[model samples]
Target: MLFLTRRRKVQREGIDYEQIDKEWDWDHFLILQAFVGATVFFLFPSLLHGLPLWDLRGLMVAMVVHVGVSEPLFYWAHRLFHKGYLFEHYHSLHHSSKVLQCFTAGFATPLEHLGMCGVMAAPILGATLMGFGSLGLVYGYILFFDFMRCMGHCNVEVFSSRLFESLPFLRYIVYTPSYHSLHHMEQDSNFCLFMPLFDALWGTLNNKSWQLQKDVSSGKNDQVPDFVFLAHVVDVSFSAHSPFLFRSYSSMPYTFKLILLPLWPCIFIVMLVMWAWSKTFLVSFYKIRGLLHQTWVVPRYGFQYFLPFAKDGINDQIELAILRADKMGIKVLSLAALNKNEALNGGGTLFVNKHPNLKVRVVHGNTLTAAVILNEIPANVKEVFMTGATSKLGRAIALYLCRKKIRVMMLTLSTERFLKIQREAAPEHQEYLVQVTKYQAAQNCKTWIVGKWLTPREQRWAPPGTHFHQFVVPPILSFRRDCTYGRLAAMRLPKDVQGLSVCEYTLDRGVVHACHAGGVVHSLEGWTHHEVGAIDVDRIDVVWRAALKNGLKPV
Candidate 1:
């Protein structure tokens, strides 16, 4: 549920992947070892032989000891760890992570973890020493302790402020994720083990805990993004890759998951529900050089783009998303994947034409798409095969490459469309643009720029050692083992990108689709023009250079 909901996140900032990589394994191993040791020790017949299997009396005693003895002991120990040498050497490690997650609960130095283990064992030992100990009491208390520890460090505010407002006493009894997050942030306050009551008694509680919890739980802290990447779902299987569903899954390139096969029916139902009822919704968000960047999903699938009946509905969603971004004061809104399909919305020209005065720049971002694709072509090579040769990106690539005096075999049946694109090139270079009616014409070309899908049979037409660079949606399958395939155009984000725990579709960490990078470049340059409609072949290099200047490297 925490993964599914955005408003519940207490910190708004993303988890630090680098810190997790460094600390997560060791921390979890230590925690697991501690738990295993405790379990093994308690399983001894000599130690717990006389204990009853169940005892309500011992449970009540354990709760009393937890409040009266355990809380105060841990509270003082935690406070001591904050002062002088203990903090500098031990407790500071735990506090080092500015962002917290579930694993963060165990991310402490060995000595500090040992101290915590002792604190957790206190109530169990106390109850057992009183001759009222039970197996159930020991197991229940230890598990409850661990559960509360994990909950407090989860960094998602699960409990609403109203829960405390109605039963105000509960606030002192149990600490919350928001409460502990304050402790991590401020370092000196909110130091207590699962109970804020001790902090209140010791005058160490942060006063703003309740208000911050209220604000975060109510989503008042979610700021408007400076840039929005208007994206769409690719397919049912790929929908499971949403960051809201699984962080680890979304952080890598997408592949067909056999594990997801069982869930396909349920996922299909969700897609249907989304198609019927959902509008544009926030998928994920991060910061690039302090400017907020958000990705909002269009709720339509990729195949839907080709559906004649679905076109109007998809366009409506796109227009609505663009208008919503403008109203939110977003500086740039880039259309990703099929959201900028010319046949559907004329590369976002429909929205820009409808709303003539939109403050937010509606960018198709195909200029950079064309640029990335064009740049990937081997410069020394004189000729290349081009598929989807008359499409928006294809036209730009064909024209741009022809201007370089490179021979381009544009595979298209429409002579009119081929001639139109060829005419856009310089008169001296126009002769380099040749129209081909079949893929067989590309048998000799080693460099093939694909903007259309190719079947395995059609792929056979390519010569050995041919490399296929693609910009097609649901990228073409690699059927020829002898040839190489280039992935969809993507660019690595600036190194300063922060809070970016989620991947953009199948792209790897810190890499985003070229269209998405285009928007970032637009915002970084503070360009006021809307990059809608046809791709300007001239600005392709300009955008590419600006992207490099802003630290966006081609992938």
Candidate 2:
């Protein structure tokens, strides 16, 4: 944000969002600014009782300094500024001219001005009464952040135009004239009264942390629809809902990195640790492959995947999935939910028949533990095709596989019966399920009834309504009230799917997914799936082995 704000042209949602807000009386603002600064500075040292408050709890004090004081003050005061009557009294001036010019900064209502004073009011008075020197970090931070505010609010862009064009780092050192420009023009634009972190975190920030990316991306609109706006509120209340419609954490701001780091090393360390862990799988790919004494296999639904190992011709669905995958060039580990001791290379047509190149290994079905899934995924996985598991199980498996750094296809069956069959077999997949039975009718799902429903017996393959062919591209749920089971049996969901508990599992690269209906090859090549596709038994045994032996597979 600071970077773009340094520019000369007018832009909305630029770092200058504050510039667009109601104008504060220059005298009042300056007075308040100086008064607040002087008061905090002189009185703050009194809180230490002639001792330092930093000794006992540095972090706790920093918390009290910023969160305990500044955060709540800004939130409530900003709320006050938005209130109708009070806003009209003092706040209106700040917002009077929505399309603010560069000079419009430092503009605030007088009452709003009092809130600024409140910054040091507590610390100074409290420190004086407590018979200690003003030692709290809140005081120091208030001084530092507030001074920046005054400087940032200055209508003047501090550097020469030529200097800014050449040296980008100057943008970081100062909040340029352009930074506050977005605040005044756009209603929902900049609201970070004195701090930039909130705006960055809430996706409301108007400028870039570094000046470099400004021209390419820093312009901000800040307007949101009623639904998106409402969702933001709900997201704060629910962690799962925080899916990051606009996630800045993945890409944080400089204030968080530079300012907060001094006082928050743990946070910095955590970020570093997370960084190392993410690339760990990538860096150690060959090492993990060398430890590849055994390969892991995850069996799909319809395959009735069982222990006696390959004892079941693999489930029909499983074979079908494999056949479909073979055509698409996807290779994957089929984990059996029922067996914990099983190895990835164990039992199956590939293991016993033994294709010279195609090596089959079995793996513990639970190899995808919650914790492992939480962290990293193996980099070797090319594509993942999963079908017929409980939503929870699917998620667990997906989560596990994803952490291994592998992307999963997350094959889904729209019908409850299909899901149930998958559930009975694997019983533990996670993701979404739209009970087609509840939408249509129980008889709609019955093969016999479906057969009868078709106009001509010869065309009974998929029938009309229940055909899986229609949703191959994107699954859209259609529910009929009368056809639906009672609410008890009805799958609980929002009135509209957009409102439902939606969680998207990202498919990883190199993994081809062959779903039940078809298009498995399309989704595979489209996404660059890595697993070699093997069709007929011979293809699975011979072709796949040859590639595996040659250290290259069609995937």
Candidate 3:
């Protein structure tokens, strides 16, 4: 592990297929379910058979609409179902059983699951009856979607070189286990049906999120909620018998009351306590934030919260300076930003990358604080921005430093087009710093002004008007090509160096002092993947004082 020296990095888990049986099938269940679905399908046609426009063209349109349109739409809706209130009150059951059995494929709270299926199927059914009848296309739609829906639930991981995935246009077009399994994994982002065309087109599909899952230690598994774990067990063991299908009303009213009477008291108490918890701050909010805030774990854009005047304009920065204060090893992140896809595609600021060091903070309030990706910043950070789009929360600190006279670089999140056209190509960091600017979402990417990273020393040195540049990323090799040299290079920080990218650019004057990655790898200049269990990078540790009770006061 050249990467894991005395330093610690987060753990990454890959696909764990041990729980999924490749050969497993529920033919009888499949047949039965298909019968039920078909019965519904035919019933619609029969009911409307006497309608003026009953025809097969409508059916074709319906199938196509379902496969191409409805599927991806469901993916978007499903992702929401996995979050917040939806997760706790609705969708969690489907995933309660981590080990899914074939029969459990469609098992769900009848009202919730069945209701959604009907809702999803309605549009297609309507479209079909109005016009569709092309046999080959319609059958293709049915067979293809059926297999994917079944296998989507199966634990099997396959690399079948099927046409949709093997052919060029189609290769990236289809959704496979390698593409959809992430739905059952961490349960975020990977929203797509058997087809990825719509999902990918919208930038909402999580293709990369679909890598096979690796098993965490069984011990860790035990730590997850018990209800979830039990669901998996039952999914594998039981068929979809109605939870109350067999229970008849043979129970007289008094007996029924006797059976449900205990539950009422328990439910009442639970509701009362829940009501109290909501009105007070006694809920496990912090713990809940830790366990549920997936955004906290995304490393790359995580630190936007720490940047000073990160997204605020000049006026806002001045106002914010009234508010606070606050990168890369020699592998200077020449630049980086948070790019929201919907807007600001044209480009603005330069971000950095291809380095080994960065210190980031999470940006709160519609800025770029996705993850705190500071892996190699120590390896090349000299002139650093304590804040990125993700670290906008650090604005006050950056502002304070600025009030103390530090010129901080305000970088815009990155983009592909702006980068492709740059005269002197800004290494990777600049690319990451571009923020897409749009209306509903003001931040599409981050754009930085050159003055952001000027150091205190640079402010005073030399005569006025001279150019003093900060960490401008230099071209370097990618990880697959130079992993070792990159790290050892970090180890080689010159003892005499103050810092790699650390610089004092007094453009109002002239002092060209460069900073090194690790204070001084001795650099005149410089330079930056994962696996396995629930590999977690130690979260950013923040200190909080106990209110007045703890003798701590709010500033």
lDDT value, candidate 3, whole model: 0.31
- Write down the lDDT of every candidate, Cα atoms only: 0.84, 0.34, 0.31
Question: What residue runs in model 2 are displaced by over 4 Å at the alpha carbon?
Answer: 1-25, 30-64, 97-105, 120-142, 154-179, 200-213, 216-555
lDDT tens digits by residue: candidate 2, 287-373: 112121111122222122223454443333233333433332333333222222122223233432443333222112121122222
Q: What is the lDDT, from 0 to 100, of the residue 550 in candidate 2?
A: 30
Give the per-residue Cα lDDT of candidate 2 at 322.
37
Candidate 1 regions exceeding 4 Å error are 1-10, 26-65, 83-90, 109-147, 154-171, 214-220, 252-284, 304-313, 423-429
* lDDT for each residue of candidate 1 in 432-472, tens digit (9 for 90 to 100): 99999988898898999988899999999999999999998
TM-score against truth, every candidate = 0.84, 0.27, 0.29
Please, what are the lDDT tens digits per residue for candidate 3 over residues 138-168? 3454565566676655433434334433465
Instruction: Provide the RMSD of all predictions against the true structure, rounded to 1 decimal.
Output: 4.0, 24.3, 26.2
State in Å the error of residue 270, model 3: 55
Candidate with the greatest lDDT versus the true structure? 1
**Candidate 2: 10-residue stretch with minimal lDDT:** 225-234
lDDT of 2: 0.34
